[model samples]
Target: MKKFIGLMVIGLTALMVLSGCGDQKEQETSSGTKETLTVMASGVKNGTQGVFLEQFKQMVEKEYPELTVETTLLPDDQYLTALKSKLSTGQAPDLFLVQPKKASANSVEELAKAGYLEDLSDLENWDKIKDQGKNDMSFEGKPYALSSSISVLGTWYNKDLFKQHKIDLPTNWQAFLAACETLKQAGVTPIVMGDKDSFMIQFGMYQVAANQVYPSNPQFDDQLYTGETKLTDDVWVKTVTMYNELYKKGYVTDKSLGLGQPQAQQSFVDQEAAMIFDGDFSLTAIENDNFDLGFMAMPANEEGETYLSAATGAGYAISKKSQHKETLKAVFNKMTDGQSEMFTNWLATATSFTTYAEGDDLNPVFEEIVPAFEAGRSFYWSNQAWPSGTETEMQAKFSEMIGAGKLKPIDVTEAMQKKFEELTK
Candidate 1:
């Protein structure tokens, strides 16, 4: 019952925010002063970023007597498309977006270097938030973008299903198989997936791959990218082998191929699958489903080592073309008020931790998994860390290998090396 109500709220919030709420809705609001700001946000419905916009109205706009703001929401998939036109023309949004990815990230760094992002250095609270928000959210020892929140991801599961079916959660390769077999015997799917969105499959691959690639340290894929190490390294092969085995064993839900997020998510909500390996953002869906979800790392290797599921949030960038630097700064300062509040609320409720020091109470579930991630010192999300097309190529090749019956651990390692080679050359 709780899950049903939660899902209803989740569905409505998503629907209202996306559908007719006008892609660009400017409240007929006013500040007694002369400054009125037009804020452009990336994607109104997906990503917690939208929640910032919606909450901004109630929290910032209503409270500030001297500042007025409007919002223009764009879809995430098309954010770049719209951003190109807007940024090229000087009439771009006062604030836009940036999330670090593998390929085009250098360009993002370039943008920040070139002053395409508003510098909040002069803000009053800048010093207060810097200790936690600096490295992960912003760059160059400055708060170019405030992270509001950061997170760790891994295997999200339903504890009730696991207990009822008497299947222990797997912590290693062999144990994982045993658990899956037990679930299968009980007519419960071991995992739920939504491969209709390619990123879902990619994230699964990345989560498993991270363990093999970065079993122990801050280096994660940073070294691999810089050639400090090679993917043909044994660990990479084993990572691919581990995940492919799960796929072969029928542990991952078959509906994953046919379903997009919503439809596929039903498998978990309906309790047909015991687990799904996704990120913190999926918490909204989980709350909506009202399931008593639990989480753990992707089962580790024989040595009790595993990788991490982690990625930074999309950073908000100033329009390269905006003429209102001073005005933008003022508006952005106000946005921070909105950003910070939303950041804490969203993260605390969503099982994520913010890099921001002034964090909200941790989600109850995060308490269980956070320590494991930190203790392991495991890290990396390949697509987020690598270049853009690298993910497309590598993930596609991974799926093809699995489908083709040739995706061994070593094959995965070799394939990563080849893909990385192609991308670099």
Candidate 2:
């Protein structure tokens, strides 16, 4: 969170969808009269982000002088469910924002491939965006979305608090556990965690699996795609077993599994918990806590390393189904180039660093842990990077496994094995 209540408090839904379903089409909004470019983004439009976006819109109208745009904000834990509902009613917004998160990606891509999202492969400014940020929607060698920024996911903690607790920061798996155990005995909940939101598990899973898949080890994703390696390999077992042990140890708070993300974060902020395993979004984790915070990725295993996490947000996609393409492209261009800087500033204000470029300043949390951030092992998180539908079943099973107390480190890998066989077909 950088999302106050969930990742939702951040309120950048339409912004998130930029990559998954962008399309380019002919102009419809008259030079001044206006053809409305209705947009769908989740979250309230009254914050600093709204102001920045509004400013961008004003400038676009002044600069382009031919378009009028309208935006709608949708918020709910059932975000994807809402998008799906819109599709069935045949009322998808002219241009809606999406995230690489499961439902968002699945719906957006299907819509795009099926000619719902405008094929923006020819946008003039496409080259300006970063390649890594576009990983979600660069399908079949053609660009489908306008990805503007990138954010890295790592564990955030209060350094001053760590010192006060007299615990050394962890650098490896053993070290990680020692610190967690130390916190436990001290009446400090080792981790402020929540799986109420499915995406949360992805962070945990990535912490354990990214290094194994980093730089393209087809041993997992690729093999599953091609029906090569079995999912029930030793790798899966080791991964799941790690989680199983962690859960069995009472390291996590009991309320965590029951609490939604927002509450979980507030608990951490209140100091009910000592450490939180999360991403840059932690900026908003403790909305009430002005306390100094520190951040780094999941502590290392025996290798004392982790894969760098690249999560999704603020991607622009053209609706292939839209009758008006030019205006849409123009709107996106304005949104990405003119408005993005300001809009991202608000997001940065609301949370931490999400944009690819510089903002007002680095989140204080990032400042404290910069040394560890640059050092140690890092990898591209696998969950966000996986092809569509690759990990849905696995994630669901993982949650079930955790609640059932039937999981182990190896099960993480094994569950993938089971999931792969079902998914590939």
Candidate 3:
């Protein structure tokens, strides 16, 4: 009897083990093999790109139940360093952020040249991208990244302050200067710039360059690359001089070199300043202020000519070494198809103008600058076409000119030319 009882117990134990193994196999078949896609970028957790990343992960997982997405976001400097290290070490993420053209260390052209970016030419939504955006993310005539939005850089001004001081919106360089003078005379800060951040310099200077440099010579940057034109040329000198005049005349806030971009933005939000130069991406920071706001292209041109400094914003590029190429490609196709729920969510979350046809209704604040786009009077941000370090050189020299008054406009241009030569070589 004891022997029989022991045999029964053994049989039940074996049956239970087999049943557990069968259930495990069934679960694996039902759910499929799990895979993970990795993405990396430079942005804050709640920033536009961050929000987009979260949405992308959710949508992708919903569509492919067996896939998981992992994201790592760092500050700009740290991201650049980490991305370069990872790419070199053969451990880069499946998809990573890259600047348009040669605009940064991790730009599409540079990575494509280094044979790190995957060719995305055959993406399903390839034809839907605007020509300019396509060009911005292309290298050697092949698309390497997916650019989704157009970033417009312009003046974000407090409408209440402008009205309180009885100042009309300026449509030309002379009028702009006059308005500044009027605002200064009224004891209002005409503009607030955070020169301490260095990059803030580009916000105002690029607008001036769009008018003074590109209108007559749209090929200036191309010529620069080919050694056909130089930064020390008269046009750049004039561009620098025109932008410097604002600082020289004390129209910008005092001690601007000590303030950071956030502080300057806060000043504008608090209505302590009439204007701040920024891109459409900054809307989230300034949009919620109690007073009304307006955005317009800085009219740095003469009376009849108008130009806007705009460009394709940063976007994602796929690593050539990624094992999940097909999955990443599918994500891009679905997100930018111009018809998917993901596409609609992306348009709403994007702070910049949509590159696709579906999202054309811009915020009321950007309405004033629509004419420039319609008239084809918009130029890509000057630095977008230049080598990566060119803007850094410009920022440093321009800050010297503003803070110490030690560098003249000509000196600034000469320094830029030297840096450009060194970088190109």
Candidate 4:
């Protein structure tokens, strides 16, 4: 009887020890007394996204003394592959950057569809996001990411050069061409394009489409999805023709097809060119202390009818496989509070307009087009609504048009429509 009791006690003690170990494992998986929340994104360590992540880590660590935030930033070329690989293998970080809509492989819509992103609609501060931003970050009526900034696509011109040439900012297609002629006659390259970097083609083309396509038919992309309309429609042909006209007129820099984006940006900053069409993201690359820079909506329409190409900036998304989901949610909630130090620091790092109401002060370079954005005379980036590869198709066909001079605008649109059908199907 004494031996039996002693054996029972030993067994009970072992059971208690095993139970304690299980509890410790559970706590470690969740937000334990000491846990790490990992973050990954694509950008330079000191770039806007890097600053945003550093601020986020500081805020999270300060708020939750027991938690540490670890961040890793990769260049754009490697990020998507690494993220997709990590996600497919169930090794994704707690949080990562995701583009709005189906803009990229790591876009909110794509990742949410693949079950890699958490459904963030239930977040406490979800409603604080701007309606347009909400739409961009949502897939099938459910939010998957948080976008704090709004990116605008337009023309960045040398203010000092414009002042020296006594040329006024153009407000319409006709006036814009006249201004280009003026610059050309003055022996200045009116516009510079890095067509060698095929994606740069969209910077100008999408701005033109914003005015020529969406203003009249806001549901154009939806119509395409439902077979109600096609990219080969006359509107797209017109948009392409207008964009081609710039190349045909020799208004753009000579042999632009041979130059990459960095070269084109360098030319603009060196005062060899008067203007370059780009998005707000390029401000850091194009801005020069030697001259004041000015940005404006591409005057692709008639007077008083130009449309701005703008959309929600890419932002953080929580991984569905993250063990620290609750902690990540708390961090995101704090960020959207508007009164938090995190929110203020985020607004300060914004290179473009912010989606939050507290972000009222516009960047001086973008001041010229603030009215258009405020007046709702703007459209989201066209490719954001389409599948990822559609823009690549457009770029390739358009490059054929510009380089080989073999494909017409109609031909380019036909190819784009075909590629769009294949991708969506």
Candidate 5:
């Protein structure tokens, strides 16, 4: 009887082990194989692109349960270079952010032409994307990227400082200079700028360009592309000369050459300057200090009306070589939904006008430019029509002009034209 009981116990133990193995196999099958989706983007974690990525990751992981989403956020300069290297090495991330066609190095059209970006025409939300956004990200009639929002380039000012000085916001180029002079006399930095990030030059110049170049010759970009116009033309020269006035008058912060975007933004937030030329993307950083701030169009030609420099913000695209594109598409559909919290957080952080059908309510500072947008008195960023690396070249030339103090605006304009001509050839 004792021997029989021992055998029975051993049999029971084996059966229990087999049952446990069966249960483990069932669990593994139910959970499915895990896949990781990698995303790379430009901007800080608290910035628009970062917020969008985080929200998407959460929404996607929650919805898919078996997918892991990983992201890397880099500064604009580094991000473009890194993405290019990754693409060349055949190790591109599943999803990466890119600017619209003709905007930057990692632009949608450039990447699509290189056969790196995937065609997103079949996306469920493709029709829902605003026409402007679609057009910006499309190449050869195929959409490739998802624009987060639209932003305006303008002058952001400390409202309290203006109010204390009893200064009315300038509505014309002369008035703008006068306001800067007044601020200077009051011992205030008239404009905060970070020239180290030469692209910041565009923030100030595009507004002027919109007023100077686009209003009369709306076909300037088309003409330039077709070799009928040049950056050295009277309109471009006027734009550059007018924009250089701020630098010439010592209105820009002396430390601008050494300052980066973060430092410059901090200076503005700390009220070291009365105004800063920036885009709506910087609004979150400005507002965090709870300083009463206001925004205005760059008073280009003084029509006493705003002419905005507006464009669709940089967006995300899937790599054509990605193995997990279907998964990414699903995640993107959920994240880009106008009704989703993902988009809401993005809008709040970005403070830019949304391209969604149901847009977020505008903050009062942004409300000032709404009329321009409504009146369709806005011009897209001129860089959007420029060739790759041309903006960088312009920045370098302009920086040299500003730094060396002998290189005139004409020199910068001619150099830019040469670079543009070279790229076109």
Candidate 6:
């Protein structure tokens, strides 16, 4: 009986030891906790948005050792579809990109209305974001996203090439044509066009329209939307005509319609062409070269004045249903704290100005046009007000017009007007 009692006591002691070990393991597991966050960003995997996310993830992991961040970077079209699908299914990422209000497919206003995005009105970072950016991403007067940057569209040229040919920078449309003619005479392509992507044509056309169309009638878009005016109006035709002049005068490349954006950009970089119409975003690929580059607002009118196409670019928004809001908020705070390394890294590669406080010195390429933005000599791209698919339709119709070469500019404008009417109807 004493031996049996001894065995019972030892068994009890062994059981206690096993139980204690189990508890220790549980405590360690609980103490070493981790949270994960996912983000859906637009652009190619190696593009700006992708690079931003990569840096952001490293910063977050370093700052919050218990957190892990993962991002799925996709091209624009795929990103839009994925973002909408996830939002509608209540599986949205913890953070996602939101384009300005009225932007096609991923409009912040629409997302906010659907209760899929958090209201960032109370975020302390609001003090850092530009007021125009806040207003651009707001819904019902409440901020819904954090604008990353502002992009401007203009004429980017090779300075050395211009100097070599003694081509003075033109300030008026006529002089711009003269410069192009001189460059052509020197056996240089005046403009490298990527009309294979119709949107490329709009890069220049819209800048022209900013000066030729909006200054005369700032409310023209509103009137056109209300059907009180038509694209057949004189201002629009002039804008279209001004845009086509580059092609009509043989200043653009001979195989412009066959060339893609990469090819055209490369042509300019290789000194095969003197100029190309593109946004500040092109600077990513441009900054690597040793060429002396300069940017100028498109010279479209007779007054020798230039106008820029400026607008708020993409921004970030927190998911209303995210389970990791605090973690995401912390990341955002660190990113915009101004003194953080994230800010510096972002400023270094950005093609445009950050909407958050003044970034590091503007890229030298924008030296000539920075004054235009500062002086309020810029206009928002007109398509910003249109509903989804309208601009895409216009781009397609414009491409067709380029091919037919028979449709008057007014006819092209009329087709755009008709599509707008039908789509909105």
lDDT score of residue 12 within candidate 3: 10
TM-score of 5: 0.87
Worst 10 residues of 4 by lDDT: 1-10
lDDT of 1 by residue, 1-425 (tens): 00010100111121112211211223233543434555555544554556656655444444443446666666544655666666656566666556543324322454567566666677655554424345544557665654444455577788887788776767676787788888888888888877666567665676776666665545656787678877777666666677777777888876566676666667777887888777665676765445577867777566664556665555555564554455445443433343543223433432365544454466677666666645645454565556455656556666666566655557656766777778777
Worst 10 residues of 3 by lDDT: 1-10
Please report how far candidate 4 places residue 319 from its true position, in Å: 0.5
Judging by lDDT, tell me the better candidate of 2 and 6: 6
Off by over 4 Å in 1: 1-36, 44-47, 54-70, 101-110, 130-132, 288-291, 305-307, 320-351, 358-360, 373-376, 403-425
**CA deviation > 4 Å runs, candidate 2:** 1-34, 43-70, 75-78, 85-90, 100-109, 212-219, 287-290, 334-361, 368-377, 385-392, 407-415
Q: What is the lDDT of candidate 4?
A: 0.78
Between candidates 2 and 3, name the one with more favorable TM-score: 3
lDDT of 1: 0.57
Model 2 misses residue 351 by how many Å?
5.8
Tens-digit lDDT string for candidate 4 (19-120): 111122423535346777788877766566665566667655654555577887777658878988899899999988888877877778889888998888
Q: Supply candidate 3's per-residue lDDT for 175.
A: 94
Native-to-model Cα distance after best TM-score fit, residue 421 in candidate 5, in Å: 1.2
Determine the C-alpha RMSD for candidate 5 after optimal superposition of all C-alphas. 13.2
My TM-score estimates for the predictions, one after another, are: 0.78, 0.77, 0.89, 0.87, 0.87, 0.87
- Each model's lDDT comes to 0.57, 0.55, 0.78, 0.78, 0.75, 0.71
Candidate 5: regions farther than 4 A off: 1-33, 45-59, 288-290, 336-350, 358-360
Predicted structure 6, TM vs. truth: 0.87
The global Cα lDDT (0 to 1) of model 5 is: 0.75
lDDT of 6 by residue, 1-425 (tens): 00000000001111111111112221223658766768777765465665556766765555455567787877667777888889888899988777777766777777888899887766667778777777888999988876556777888898988999998989898899999999999999999978886668778878988898888778887787788777678887888888887888889887888997878888888888889998887776655465788888878878946888887776778899887665455545545567656445444444566676664377677888877777778887766766767677667766776777877688778877777788678
Which RMSD does model 1 reach against the true structure? 7.0
